[model samples]
Target: METFKKGTQRLTDNEVDQLMKRQPHLLKQSYDQIPNLTPNSQEVISRQATINVGTIGHVAHGKSTLVRSVSTINTVRFRQERVRNITIRLGYANAKIFKCPKCPEPQCYQSFSSEKESNAQCELCKEVMTLVRHISFVDCPGHDILMSTMLTGAAVMDCALLIVAANMPCPQPQTQEHLVALVITKLKYVIVIQNKVDIIFRDQQAALRNYEEITRFIKGTIAEDSPIIPVSAQLKYNIDCVLQQICNFFPIPDRQLQVPPKMIIIRSFDVNKPGEKPENLHGGVVGGSILQGILSVGDEVEIRPGRQSKNGNQTTWHPITTRVVSLYAEQNELVYAVPGGLIGVGLLIDPSLTRNDNLVGCVLGFPKQLPELYRELEINYYLMVSVVGAQQQDGKTQKIAKIQQDEMLKFNVLSNETPGRVIEVREDKIMRVALNNPVCTGLQEKVAFSRRLSNKFRLIGWGIITDGKTITL
Candidate 1:
């Protein structure tokens, strides 16, 4: 038995270790009786079932503000985004919905509360209850020139929140384009967020008119059935209702971890600090979502279309092999990564090779498990009835011209965008395209096609990759 002096005495480290070893049952008992003090400790542990929801709308339409409202971590990474007040690249944030113990109603709790209070009591009831769910928000840029970035963000989303500002007229240019993209991406789950209600809080008639216009515009679109929730993300008004709708609509998709691990690299960077010792420096980190299977730490991985190399008169892409040193989901360190949400993978590779997002658009997977690299792709595409987001005369949809042979086009697959030329147009609507840069993609993968109309690449349509090959031309 260990005895202490009447006043107080501190045990030496060796003595403490000896006591713990001799009375291991004491330690076991202490461990077994440990209480879960986390406020939502009783909540269903479904962290692995993370749902990805994307924000798409016109520029200055509160896409970033909406994400900032709900997310615990700042999704905006670049200083330029803060300065310019527009998302230049894809931004991600993790958020949770918690239920109030005192309130039986669904929307009686906070929706956009800070994550620092994750384990704190409910603000309204002051009682702790299990959190309802967790979701990842993908903030897509609304700028016209960044349409390709928006399309890529839409690809990985299970659901979308199409934001429309109430102060502005309904169906802003990007709003229409984003809705079209939802249809092209085959996204069935959607919620239309009519944000900035506070801007028109005093103007009831104007707010009603804007709402009606927005409803009319979305009538024939794919989002026709989506619920329109009026919110004030800036003022944190009606955010709870938005969260309730999301919970009801966006359920987790079935993921198969039995298949080979594969991930699309959306953003990559060298994370080493300046003046850090070379021996202590960490490797570069690749951030994106896993499409399928599981990637565990220390797993050997290969990145395809890895680095550009000049082979005589032609350019070639060689696969790069590296080991995953660490894995992270949101801000939490993860031992293994699974499908359904975004992840960050730390790799044991040369930092210089991954700096400045050089590895962006590359595909990561086990050796020989990635799809074929293609310089030429055959796609069966369909043109939209009207050119989306384009200025139309008389407020009517305008007919777009069919793709012509030998015409230059832009192809977007996953996050990779490449310039290509139409080589062959088939009667069955299949068009063969020769890309200027090679891409790592699989058959049946959805690809968005754009045309240089009026000197800008406007999204025309999307198609599945049917065939790919190395073209000599």
Candidate 2:
């Protein structure tokens, strides 16, 4: 409760208090102390963001711009990201949606930063605006090489915002790939943002044509019926409409708060600076979204497939067990964190172990309660008609061939990505894969498969884990 460190940003005791003072609901710093606490509990809602909205589309399509304009907080914090003018790693920002009861319809719905007072006042009626929804945007990289990074972000998404640049064609290469990815992950609720409308504002005919092209592009796809809203993220235009749709359409899913807590490690960091005293050196900080249950400070947690070492041709992974020292959602410290948005957990361990995302794709949960780790799996697989973004020699889409014996393919299950060789392809759509890097997964889990297209793996289809060879440690 005194201090916490995330990346290079450190908040002192008084500074932490100054940030937490706005949310009255976070009065107690204990998990059990909260009365009848749900994910929507006032204290939690006032302080924490519950919904995880993933912003995805082609590169330079304004995914980051849309998130920045709405959240007022830039997701691109990395120096490399700023220099490249694109998101390389997964970026995040939280915003609170407020609604004035007296104002008319969608006009009353507006989005503000997470730091905005929970009891926000409406600009129109001066009425106290109720906090309707608090959402966190998972700003995924849209670069072709960063497709794997985008899939990892898609794992925890409750819904998606598909950005389509009006200046570009309806379906760019990554746009199609990402849409198919949404289908592979079974993300059904989507909002299509036709961004860069300002570039086409002078031409009504061009705008209408672009809209029709978008409709045709999404036809027969998961986003066929998704509402397409024109917006200028650079100009901050029609942002309220996006907020209104999010509040109106996106339903709050039922969270598994009673189950044993499970969180997927997506980002990890060493927050210590050079020349810091040994006594003041802090442990690693793990950042991710909890899939189920609640996690609190002082809880002993285990990260599976944690540390890997190879010895004389035999490979083994050692699990790391550490006590939760602190829990954080952005700068706001919490007694306990619910299962949504990206949360950073401070662990009492050597920071070097978690440094530079060494723990990314690891699973964190109660000790000995997680699913088994698998080195080989038997999956019921299915391939799409053709690769979404690739063309063939005959001037048509490239159809995917059958998985060959001993072919190397990429698989993404949960937050982990591993390259696996086809060990056996049997009848009844059953295929066995020997993972290059073992992953911790359970029976009946869904995995997205990909192939090397021009030296980069492009998503082809998905499969279900029917059986697997588990590793006993």
Candidate 3:
């Protein structure tokens, strides 16, 4: 650590001022100005994304391909994902949306990759376009086995892009299930992307029939009014129209700056290379979007349900404490980060603790200000009418039954997942669960439930934390 800091120097006040003049998102201090910050504030969106837009649909429907077409990023980076040609983990990328104030209607809007200059010139107008929205794409896996992972991603989503294949019939298996996850998560804003239009382009009547099928599919769902944009992600056709629709349809959500800092960890890594010099080794880096409040450089933080220990048949969790060494949004460094785009927090801790996403799903905040660690939860549950993502039997979807005692279920709480068993049921609407691993959660946090069917877990219901059993530090 000393070697890593030996030649480096902190920026002077003049340097900070100069950088802020060019990159308005640098080294933000003072909480007093937070209340005045809007989603489109030049200081905010100019540097970092304030909206989390998720890409979701069935597997092989061009979800990742569409994101790559717009953002120029291939969200699938893992070895297995590349090998399997699927998104196994929740993938992320950032894009900046700019609009030419003088241009007409749809042609005015354009989306550039994260590294693009905030004030880029418009291609059509030849004038500087103003940055309107910077969004982080939470690319969720469409595989049935990763349904709970999708549910966890939904927790941070402000809006979603439902990518449906133009060639396939409406509502594929994971497509239906991902939509249901969005509904239960209460995500209101959605944009439906009819990708792979090139495949069905030659058949005009079939295309129209498929379009009508899409319209009917979303008739009563959350995306009922969402614009269905047809495009070929592979050929990058009509992608601008998709960008225009995104800018027009999705409204920036209300940001929370007055509350305590809350962040859900989706990915954590030890960025050090193999066999690096001891003096050059840095600490662990944790990445996720802030839920509320502000995180600053040098502030001390705590992670809940941290490390586990067992003593004589009793298990205990110890909260991990560390100080923030740096903050980042993608490759852009930030002195402070608020609730908005995904944030990467550098910590002064052992790299092993965060290597390979060891800290994923943990909640981070100011010490003693975080929520309780629950070993058991009492929730007011609502079971879905049918099991989602499960294959139909005898031409009928599998009906979800009531919560049964001793039956095991999968629960996703704030990006953290745990296997839970039904311990008790009351009034047929309330249930008690014993979690296999403790979770750090606040009261009334929405929890998505899945039950195993045909040897695979299917989304069965949802619940709210009415009460819980907590363990001592």
Candidate 4:
């Protein structure tokens, strides 16, 4: 122990030592391991689809059961006590687009056949199936209290699958919260899965009526016109329909970009074992969905949090390596993963050096576009009607400057949320905003612009920030 202690003392300075004392759970790396990117000649890149599905509603609503049914994997069973211990779990499944080989007519298999035999025969010579690899789905928890978790999963999603129990037609409190979150995330594509339909199957007419009532409630919401697929996870009824719907909703994505490395770190943790060498502790494991470009092992990346630097510098950047010891998509290993997919990358850094929330609003890239700073940005938002004057701990409502259309607001934007001033209002509807400080933002970046009224901050609405410069509205 003494020898180990002395060895560890050499790796981290007194500052890190003092920090680890308070957060003992972070003592993953003992003394020598920190991530370092080594240059390599072999680079493997793959194209994969990134799908995020959230199980939302009250407790015991079968959110977990629904995800387990679709993915055939049970995350809750493994760690029931800690559902959202990490921001998200990475899941992979196979997706394919087969060309009808047996079709008497060309391209007869374009539409999926209802019958199994006909589908297998392809109605043609022989169907050619392309194994679309790297389709990832993020199974999110649905508790109202776990809003943070839901939002995290919602942040990077192609679509959402909102699961609700059929017996309970009225949207639960958590369901409402999930709806709000989906709106805030600006996720347009969503499919409502009314699970546990067995309970209501006896009363089909009542069940249909209840379903219609719920649909009416969701009118004008993000789930507008979203097909409500009813299924009994326990009985496996309509499971195939759910699968087909997913494929139809989200087709295999095509390769879009080839330059720059854009990686989003989703999960990070320290792997610590008893009586183990401190250096063996697996350091920071940052995982994210790469939106564009490709990242390879031994690539040098700059980790930039959205916040400004302490020096008052508008931009901050950190160099880290692709010390990825293990890279998995969904649950399969890959030599290299590309954008358009979800992947959990194991970094070779001391997990203690970083925190999960730190990477929430961060971006990783090469020297090019290292520090992204934006001055003026235009955004579309929705007002939170319930976000009226909020009382503070002192029982006084916080003061919020009156925002007018065409006016520019000044404030800060962090982790997809904007807390800024109301500069100008235009046409009584649109308002312009100027951030107190600049952040690394981009076009179509989902942001929750908030305003402080009285003692509480209220979310105005969620939208993408377009045009980094000044906006007219």
Candidate 5:
């Protein structure tokens, strides 16, 4: 019997009832009755364990977009990245996955949202959910020229997500190289993301064919048994599936927290703004993940092979001693940093020294706890049969030439890259090489080997530092 004026139309009581039944969410409720979607208000509890997952693939594979969709933190920092739509450097983001109470599938999840309304509903089923796990994402640049950067990103990862564009043929140049890099890094858990699935929705046959090609290409590689997840990062379609797979495949590895703390400095910067007061200027910030043990504020740390200095014709490296003034995880200040996730350490050092990533490639630990610095390294070399990313006229990988004595090669360990000259090639594949620059590394640490192909240094294989007793200073 009731009649309500709705602009030009008058709706009856029965009509309004039916409309409200169809959309129950429109019905207003009391403040207490309304579901809370505020992620911050909720006690965001995460298991002490965390895992770092790296994204690797060919250029324009939508790695940054995928990362932004999942994590609360912004991975891309450079203006060049925003303008070019390509990740130029290693980026990082962190996300917490939650399980929905009403949804049976684990894929029905949502990233932590600041908005209370958005957090109130399951992203897929509109159900209430709670956070279950927290994970750190390492976004690696996919450009062919940034292969060394990708290798550095992979070195810090416990697992990897190899993204491939569905619109293009599988195993593109950088794609092949990235896969090989994963193998060399010995990353066991992998999930292949077939991105841009939205573009192929119009053509059923094309989508099916692309899937088959991708499946076949991965069969013979190290990721043969890994799952292929079809997703549309732009549309956010099947993103939940990606998260679900991450929860299933990427398990936290055992950590030896009782040992002396060791961390590889992947990124270092002077976080001071220009024209700031001298007293307000903060110290240098070093960002990276702890490999093992725990580091706390006020801990005295030594950076080995710190800054390069020239004494006559020889370059010498000396360790730098500094105190940890502050600790940060995902931009939030922390009292300490533990193994398993990425952290930023604020050092009480001169800001000018850490500007422009000068502290990158330095290893940090307690004083005298680090391994010896070496300029000469003996490596147990193993060369790949073919060079990935190099294509012949027939679309096959070109055969790699054997490494010769006295030939120069690029050696990558952690975040450091140095030119090495092969001094002696033994019959057993062990090579004695002299580094053009000094590196602070321990024995048995993995080193990626690269050779000059055409004009670029293409990744060839991997080796281990068997002997590095020769110190530079």
Candidate 6:
């Protein structure tokens, strides 16, 4: 390492002032900031590992239950209930776990329900021991209404955990759709979870039949050879075995100087404080796992747009200066953050610097390229088209249109969601996507599109733009 001269040993006060020019909210006193760390300090403290995980399957398949059963959150709706309460249950939960929050008195009070049990149980040590050091689950919405959310969540996953009911052997029609969404993300690692094993205890033959059918359905799919662990999320049987397999299959990546300092903005928002200075419009905070890299205060960063370019074209990007005013890893703050851990960064920039009304999804890091846009793409899709529709080309009105179930299509990529014609229809494999308009794309960038149907945005498929060349409509 090179040494700095006496004059350059420290950054000037004006230099920091200039850096915080755009994001003054990050300078707040309460913001938990990560100070610069020495090389040795970064090596001593073991950073928690971060793995993006998503569940794919049909509705009511216990996709959400599996997550709630293992995380800090609990869906009270799923708990055994009486009809007297008359509460409609809509169960969906999302949670994050860091090295458990070490607290002396970790219990929070709860209201009495039936004039008894007035005290809230200690939530701290309750499942603290079960907390996976560096893993968090992206609780996915299972019903048809939430397929888009599921698909987007899967795009960022390092691995996909597919849950199949042990009682329901064959893949449901919706199961095929979920699989197609997973394929769009281009995620390679997958684990098939054979859930509700208790159903098979009474009827051995039925269980065996279901197993064979399920195996046959996924024989050539992404999870073909993945270990299928028979589990009961309700009964809590073989849960440890599932966790062990996950740990063994998806071991955490090492966190050291080797990793880069990067963070993806999965969530961003603004807040208001009473009796505060009016001039202080705090820059929004972005949250996501540090894919690779170290982040500290006073670093120059970039916020890249998530829009796809029209046609295959390269776009230029620039970096913005933002101080690490505050940092939270699994809800706890560290002096200096490390990689492989989930972090929420308080960026030092104007609130308007972000887009989409502060919606989370855009990525943040060192910006160099304009991220790229593409028009033409080749995708391997699972088309669940009806038999009648599949025979002819009058599919302009159907959900998946005139296509065979489990068929793949090549579709053109576009910026806004607009209806387009089929450029070229090919047999089961590679098909050319002829977009009605132009879109930009860069080499190796993954892009996704879906059908604009009435019920839901049925997932089409995602593919990397091969040739970064622009195409005119």
Q: Give model 4's TM-score versus the native structure.
A: 0.65
Ranking by TM-score: 3, 2, 1, 5, 4, 6
Distance from true location, Cα of 230 in model 1, Å: 1.0
Over the full model, what C-alpha lDDT does candidate 5 score relative to the true structure?
Answer: 0.78
Q: What local distance difference test score does each model get? A: 0.77, 0.87, 0.85, 0.52, 0.78, 0.51
lDDT per residue (tens digit) for residues 395-455 in model 2: 8998888888999999999889989999898877899999998788889988998999888
TM-score of every candidate? 0.86, 0.92, 0.93, 0.65, 0.86, 0.62
In model 6, the runs with Cα more than 4 Å from the true position are 1-47, 74-133, 167-169, 198-204, 253-262, 271-282, 306-321, 335-341, 350-357, 367-441, 467-473
Task: List runs of model 2 lying over 4 Å from the truth.
Answer: 1-30, 33-35
lDDT of 6 at 107: 20
Identify the leading candidate in terms of lDDT.
Answer: 2
Q: Considering lDDT, where higher is better, how would the candidates rank from best to worst?
A: 2, 3, 5, 1, 4, 6
The local distance difference test score of model 2 is 0.87
Candidate 1: pairs in clash? none
Give candidate 6's error at residue 434 in angstroms.
Answer: 10
Question: 120 in model 4: Cα distance from truth in Å?
Answer: 14
